[model samples]
Target chain A: MDILRIATSGSVDDGKSTLIGRLLYETGQVPTDRMQQIEESSKRRGLSFTDLSLLTDGLISEREQGITIDVAHIYFHTPARKYIIADTPGHEEYTRNMVTGASQSEVAITLIDARYGMLEQTRRHLHIAHLLKMSNLIVAINKMDLVGYERSAFEAIKSEVESYVNQLGASFTLHFIPMSALHGEGVTAFKDGLSWYQGAPLLDILESIKPRNIINAEGQTNFQVQQVLRPRGGDDPDFRGYAGSLRTGSIRVGDEIQVLSTGKSSTVVGVHKWGTELNASGPDQALTVLLADDIDLRRGDALIAKENDLATSRRMTASICWMDEQPMTSRKKYIYQQGSFSTKIMVDQIQGTVNLKNGELKSNHQVLLNEIAKATFKSASAIPAIEYQEGNSTGAFALIDEQSLNTVAVGFAERFA
Target chain B: MKISDFPRSLENEAIYIFRETLAQFERPVLLFSGGKDSITLVHLMLRAFHPLVPPIPLLHIDTGHNFPEALRFRDELVEKYQLTLHVRKVEDTIREKGLQEETGKYASRNALQAVTLLDAIEEFKFDACIGGARRDEEKARAKERIFSVRNDFGEWDSRRQRPEVFDILNGRIHPGENVRVFPISNWTELDVWNYIREEGIALPSLYFAHEREVFYRDGLIWPVSDFIRLSQDESPERKVVRFRTVGDMTCTAAVDSQAATIDLVMEEIAAAEISERGARIDDKRSEAAMELRKQNGYF
Candidate 1:
């Protein structure tokens, strides 16, 4: 079964948790005992309806506050597919937390209230998802039951979002569905509240989609070694292997490859995986690769294609979504890590910040909490900054505070000649 | 190529994490125990750097109450792969009487392993210790990040944690701090077993079905030879059983099943409604058991 990683984001009262609970419960993915536990807990609280957020928000404080303070992983497998939901917070302050959840997700399900068409936070989440290059933008306009199950209410919100997303100019494929996460309407069942509507249920739509291939970089190939193992006592005493999982593209035996850092040349002796030797290598497999010679390659080094696809430049400019509570300025030195390679990068300049409500760039001198800004960095050493949209491992990097050693922001490297 | 050549997403994700620790941390170590999860971690790590001898060291906190099979497997794998193995025994502390052995039915030195683990970390000065802890196993674990940082005293401050965005892991630790990386945090028990079976991964034999000396207690099977005293209510019974999880034998309970093969094992997990940790009697000790343990340096 294909995997669909979906992030749930909405306004505080939009019932984001209920939508996830409805998805899990309606699909019968939850076990009988867990459902009983939910039922019993709701009874203890003297509530008319069972609280679904308890299924995702596992913290004691989160359960007591009746709000999700952190992102939690909730899984449910259907016969046709498997689903992993990143139940992110809907509160305004936890926008950073929502990005943490949405960053790993391929699809973003933005929960909106029918009573309130589009809130500021909704736009912020869509902007984050789009900026992060999440292709599937699903506006799950929830709580249709409260609005007399009106078709016009859903249509108005959908059109408004469509116009805004167009202006955002972040490549996105979108879907708009009216849903009642609390009542399990339009989410998992066929609803005729709007006779003009003809679309698959939320579950149906989820199952129809294929798993987003991890090999997003079609032509680009970037390989980073984890470790080199020389089996000293093995039959081939000179057997040298640069072992790591291939995240993108492919490497085959007899292909000419260049080892990074040292700038040495070697041929792929073998591409081994699945506890056996393979003639070829594919993306994201735990494979041991044998090189023709005894190369001085270790972890943190890379094996690049001969076609010239990499660089060891000590400087880069990228867009960063600052997460720390304190204002982060370009003058500060932070530890920037991309893939296995990392360096001490001093923020040289903050060029611009995008307006959250309107997707326009605001002139900025610094980045504050939850602010996305373009910044140029001068590094203490050479750092890897691959395109975020091209290669996930090589493209995405984190900026860490040297004093606290806390990862304050994640950035995508934007390069120009 | 085999039809199973396509790797499971979670397993590949974990291998990628192992590579990160290798690529990033200066002094990294595999926090190995005799559990299936950690064993799977070792296997994945091996696959991560196969053909080449694994460079990272292996750190094991021996509670001294482990099943003999785990000890045997641990030794063989270490030797076979020529690993830089380091074992810190609780018995060494036991000789010093650092912890007095319990005498009653609830007698278990499982909690005392934390001291030895802390001692080992201080001795090795390991910057990153990788383990096989999954979120779905427990509620406290559910809130855990892929890279969990520990203070000089080996305390987990769950209240304050770094927000891990995308695949970007924050492995930067202060002079006295070490990060505990959980590569398989998102994987389920079924996922692990499926990957093991797919790769034909080597595991300790105790996980497979076998006739063993066991006892019935609180509607569960407790390995009689496990390192704990039994209550009078519990009686011995020689039954065919298998282990879902392996920890301190005293606290690790076995289940009655005939899943002698990996295929049957997958079938068992598919059919079994309860979680793998549900069989771990130690975790069931209290409602806040895992959280309390984590706070006190249980990785």
Candidate 2:
């Protein structure tokens, strides 16, 4: 069975945890003893109904504060596929945590309380998902039981979200499901409500959706060299392989490739995936390629197709999400970790922060915590960068503070400035 | 349309993590415990650097109360692979520090291994220590990142952890600070068993069912050990059992099962109700036992 990773974002009381618990309960994934424990905790809390959120709020701080502060990964499986849900916090201060959850996910689900309609938090999540290129979205309109299962209420929120999507110019395969997570309605199947709605249930939609396609499906092979392996004289002594995962496209034994950083050339002598020697290697596979020539290669160097030399420059403009408590300003030095390469970088300019409520790029010099902005930077080394629109893995990078050594920001390349 | 269209397998993901660790850290060591998960890691390490021994060394913190079978298996693998093995003893540290061992039925040296682990880290100056900790084992581990950073004092600060985005891991740290990398953090117990069967990896004899001297406690089978202080009424009984996890004899628990082969073990794991760590007596100490131990540099 294939694996589908989903990122879930919802505020504290949006019944996000309840929705997940209901999913687990419906699929019979929660064991009997665990369910009994939840029941006992619910009774201790003096709730007439079981508090399903108790399952997801695992941390003591979260249980004490009654709010999720970080992301928790929950796993479940069906006959057709396995699923991993990256449950992220909804508070604004924890926006960085949400980004972490969404980074590796192919689909994003945003939960909306039926009464609140569309809040700023909803827009913020949608914007981040779009920025991350999440292909499919499920705007779950929850708490339909409280709204009398009215079809108009669900339609009202759907239209409002559609308008925001249009303004942002984000093209996502959007699906809206109206249900009560507490009652397990419209999650896997609908019952006794929303006769006006004619669509598959949430689980059906999830199973039917295909894995997100890479943007440049036909892009050339771009392999980043992670480590160099040399076996000291033993059984098979003449083995030297460059180990890394293929970010895009494929490579064969005789394919000629060029180093992106050093501009050297070599022919692939061997393509090894773990132990076996494969004729070719595909995307996302960890492979070790033996080269025909002994070239000067180091970590963070890339081996690209001979015909495809990525744009290399020392300066680039990018959309940055500031995650540190210290505000980011021009002329500050930080370490830029791009793929396996790390280089010292200085912020050349801070254009502005992007406002999610309205699709506007406001002009600002300072980017504070939990703020998304456009910025330009100059790296000490000539790094190979591709525009994020081209679906390049090297386009994404993280900035670590010089003094604290904390990753302060995540950025995606926009253009060569 | 084809098998190639599917997402990456858990093996590929783990291999990716291993390569990343080798690329990012200067001095990295693999923490081997002779358990299935860590043994699986050893197998992957071989494939990851095929035809060659991995540059990384294996570090084992011996608690002086380990199952004899586990120690034998560890030595056999070390000799077969011709790999470097470093052993640190908790008993030496216990004697040097003059610490008192618990004198009850549930006395364990599991928690005391933290002191020895931190001391080894300081001695080796290892920038990264890779382990086989999976999130599905315990609640505290559910929130751990693939690359967990530790402070200079070897403490875990889960509250302010760095946000790891996509496949890019930030291994930058201060001089004394080291990172703990969990390559199989997303894998489940069933997945581990399936991989073990698929890869045909060999494990310790304790993993298979055998007749052994054991006693019952808290609905779990405890192996007879000198470290454990049994009550007056408790007596050892022979039962056909196999260990689900391997740790110190005082803390690890066994379960009654006739499933000896890898296939049967996989089936048993699929039908099991509780988590693999449910039988661990150390985690049963308190609500935040794992968290407290992790904060004090326990792997």
Give each model a TM-score. 0.90, 0.95
Model 2 has a DockQ score of 0.53
Which TM-score value belongs to model 2?
A: 0.95
**Best prediction by TM-score:** 2
Give TM-score values for chain A, per-prediction.
0.93, 0.96
The TM-score of candidate 1's chain A against the true chain A comes to 0.93
Given candidate 2, what's the lDDT at residue A90? 87
Which parts of model 1 are misplaced by more than 4 Å?
A: A191-197, A214-217, A227-240, A258-282, A285-302, A309-315, A380-386, A390-393, B1-6, B91-105, B226-233, B285-287
- Clash list (residue pairs), candidate 2: none
Each model's total of backbone clashes: 4, 0
Give Cα distance to truth, residue A144, candidate 1, Å.
Answer: 2.6
Which pairs of residues collide in model 1?
A229-B52, A229-B53, A246-A284, A386-A395
- Candidate 2 per-residue lDDT over residues A1-417, each given as its tens digit: 577889999765787778888887898777655677678878977899988777777787877777778888888877777788888888888988988888878788899999899988898888887777677889999999899999999999999999999898786789999988898888898887765679877889889877543344446688888888887887667777898877778888889999998779999988887667786544467888899998998887889999885768999899888899999999899999877778899999898899878968998889999888898899999878677642345678889999998889888888885
Candidate 1 lDDT over residue span B1-299, tens digit each = 11122236676788778877876688899989977888788887777766556767899988778899999999998988788899988889778755787667767877888888887888888889998888777767877889888988888876567788877777878888888999998887777777777768789999999999898877778888746566767767789999988887888889889999988887877777666677777876755688789988998
